[model samples]
Each structure stands twice: as C-alpha cells, then as structure tokens.
Target: MAGALLSTPNRVSLERLVQVAKERGYTAQGEMFSVADMAKLAQETLGCQAELLCGGLGGPNRDGVLQHLITGHPLLIPYDEDFNHEPCQKKGHKAHWAVSAGVLIGVQNVPSPGYIEDSELPGLFHPVPGAPHQPPSFPEESSPGAIFLLSKQGKSWHYQLWDYSQVRDSNLQLTDFSPARAADGRVYVVPAGGVKAGLCGQALLLSPQEGSHQLGLGHLPQLNPAH
Candidate 1:
C-alpha cells in the first residue's frame, strides 16, 4: 500500500510484489515481511532508493520522522502492536508496519492585552475599560504534534490519527523483528529472539530514482494536534 502511494504515475500490484519478493528471497519463513524486505521491494518495484534512519538508542525519533517528511519522503515505520491496543491473549510481541502520511501541528491563539500606557510618554497610551492589563502567555516549548498513519486493519486499510508519543513508544518497544541482509544481498528478516534487540528507532525512507519530489506546506491540511 505504501509503495503504491509513493509510486505515482506507475502502479504496482501487491500480488506481483509478493511474487517478486518470494523470488528474491526477501520474505521470512516464506511469508512474513520485514522492514528490510519492504525496503528491497520498494527499491525493485518502484525504482526508488531506500535509506534506513535509525536512532542510536531507539527506533527513529520524532525529529528524524519530521525531517524525512519535510523532505517529501514518506516513511515505513514498523512498531509493536501493543502500542495501539491493550494486551489480550497474545503471548509474544507482534509487530506491524504503517506508512506515515503527514503530521498535525495545532495553531495556538495568543490573546491581546488590549491597551497599555507608554512608559516614556505619559499620555501616549490609553487602556480599554474591560481589557485585562496582561494576557496569559503560551509556553516556549514546541508541541510534540500528532501524525497521520496509513495502516491496515483486517483486510481494509485506514487512515488513523495517533499521538507522536505512541508512535515513538511503539517503534522503540518493537521486539519481534530485526533488520538483516542475507549473503545473496537480499534483506532478510532476523528473529528478534535470536538478535535479542529491538529495532531501536529504525525507519525506512523511500525516494524516487530520479530525485525527491517535495510536497509544499500548502498541500497539507491544517489540523489540531491529537490529545
């Protein structure tokens, strides 16, 4: 699905992609798809270059994601499924992949103080009768912001709005899949138990073979941050 979204002017079928991956030996246990596998698929099927942006301590951080998005490159983010739902009867961690659509940064309104007297000129300013002397100020810190994710549920794909913290935690908590490249130069999946390490802020950025096609800020819709 993500490949299809990124491969504009060219259409790619999921069945063909699976067939190609199987032929290239990119799948795990001949069925599962890993981040590396997907990267290889994107490279071969879409004629795009793949770059893995991984953090030192965790899966890709918020800054890395935002930077890739700013460059108009959509990301393939794999994370722990527990981040989205409460643990049920499942035993081990389950990992899921999603495509980043965009981010949502809320617009903060700053109230006016109405009027104030000038310190230098005594009669230069006048205060409104009902206006407060000073209006409340917002904090200097930047908002963490939320993200738009294109994810699959059951057999259908949906767009979800998730808090950036959830995405960050999920990516860091992944413990079911690890990236690995086989001897044949195929990116194969390594069992998390064998590796004994999580993805640690890993994400894949897909760029066209020609060059990056940047998305203007005007193309994104204005939305409030998710609570």
Candidate 2:
C-alpha cells in the first residue's frame, strides 16, 4: 500500500502538510500554479495561515493597499522584480516607499537640483519625498534593508527608518557619536520588528563599504538540499 494519503485534503490534513514543511524548510514552490494557486501555496508552503501574495506577478494591481505575502507567519516577498519605485518615468501612479527609499540612497551622489544635501552625503541622501518633476534616480543598493522605511510605500503605512549601527557602537546604545558598521553597512531600525507582510524580518541592506547593489534574500534551494 502507498504511504501518502490519498483522500482530498481537509483543513487538518492541509495544515499538517504545512507543518511538515516548516520543520524541514519553507522554500517549496507551492502546488506549482497560478496567482490563486500561488496564494494557496503561500498559505501552505510559507505557513502564512492566510496568504495574500499581493503586488506584481502574483498579486492585484491596486494602489494604496498593503500588498502582503501571507497573514499569519512572516515572509519577506519582494513586490517588484527590479524593485524600482515608480516603475518608470511618467508612469508612477503612486509612490512605493520601498522603491523610494532605495532611490534616495541610490541617487545620493547624483548631481541634481533639489533640496540641499547633508555635507557628509554631499548629494547622496535626502529626507523628503520626491515628485514627478523631481523623480528619484536609484542607481542601486547592495542590500534590501535600506528600503525598509519605504517598503510600506503604499498608503497603508509610512514607517520611520533608522541606522542604529550608524548611531551606536557594539554596545547597541546611543552614543554621542558612533560609526560602527555591520557587514552590510547600514541596517534600518524599526519599532523592534514586525513591520508588515513581505517586510517583517530585517530586509538586509547594502554595505556602505562594499560597491555592491544586491538585496533580497538570495534564492533558496529548490528542494535540492545538496547545494
């Protein structure tokens, strides 16, 4: 006789499938299908209790809504493939804060007309939001955490960002002046985590010292554990 269950999956059966996945790993490609399928897969595979998988490829195209990945457990899903806020020039329907944050950091060194930049950054970083006229020029970032503030770029939120490592030394306390660094350079500080779906865990950032612009958790193995 076959070992696997043969009957249709009930709520209990389905949850068990998900639980087994959690103990082993959470990178299953899901039931292998469409948006609804992806959503269901997120719910089961990522253990999101109730998955959304919103925005971009597997989500709705609505503005001002929080495009979450799942509802229960956390999963940091990247809404955009390129992760460009505003998508393209003359086409940004609304501001995507995640993109905007990276844009600010990316264009930190561009020579453009705008608010005066801090002497330390010269023209690298800014505090205000950009308009269609003064669109941001995001060259790149080597990590994803720098854009955490803007991750909630949708109307659902407006998160305050911090570079705690920029402010504190190894002690994790505010110092008069501390410039200690992490391997990834700057890490965005939040109210102790749990920002939103697709951005709950720390979204790693680019290293100020390194000349890289890669972010997003590197691809997880596709069931092939022996990498």
Give all candidates' CA lDDT scores. 0.50, 0.26
Residue 61 in candidate 1, Cα distance off native in Å:
4.5
Question: How many backbone clashes does every candidate have?
Answer: 7, 13
Cα-lDDT of candidate 1: 0.50
For model 2, residues 54-78, the per-residue Cα lDDT tens digits are: 3221112111111111000122222
Candidate 1 wrongly placed segments (more than 4 Å): 28-33, 56-61, 82-92, 107-156, 177-200, 211-227
Residue 185 displacement in candidate 2 (angstroms)? 43
lDDT of 2 at 101: 30
Q: Give the alpha carbon lDDT tens digit for every residue of 32-112 in model 1.
A: 434556667788887776765555212324444554454445767665555444211121145555677554433244334
| CA lDDT, candidate 1, residue 100 | 71
Residue pairs that clash (backbone atoms under 3 angstroms), model 1: 58-200, 58-201, 59-200, 59-201, 59-202, 60-201, 60-202
Give per-residue lDDT, candidate 1, residue 107: 26
Best by TM-score: 1
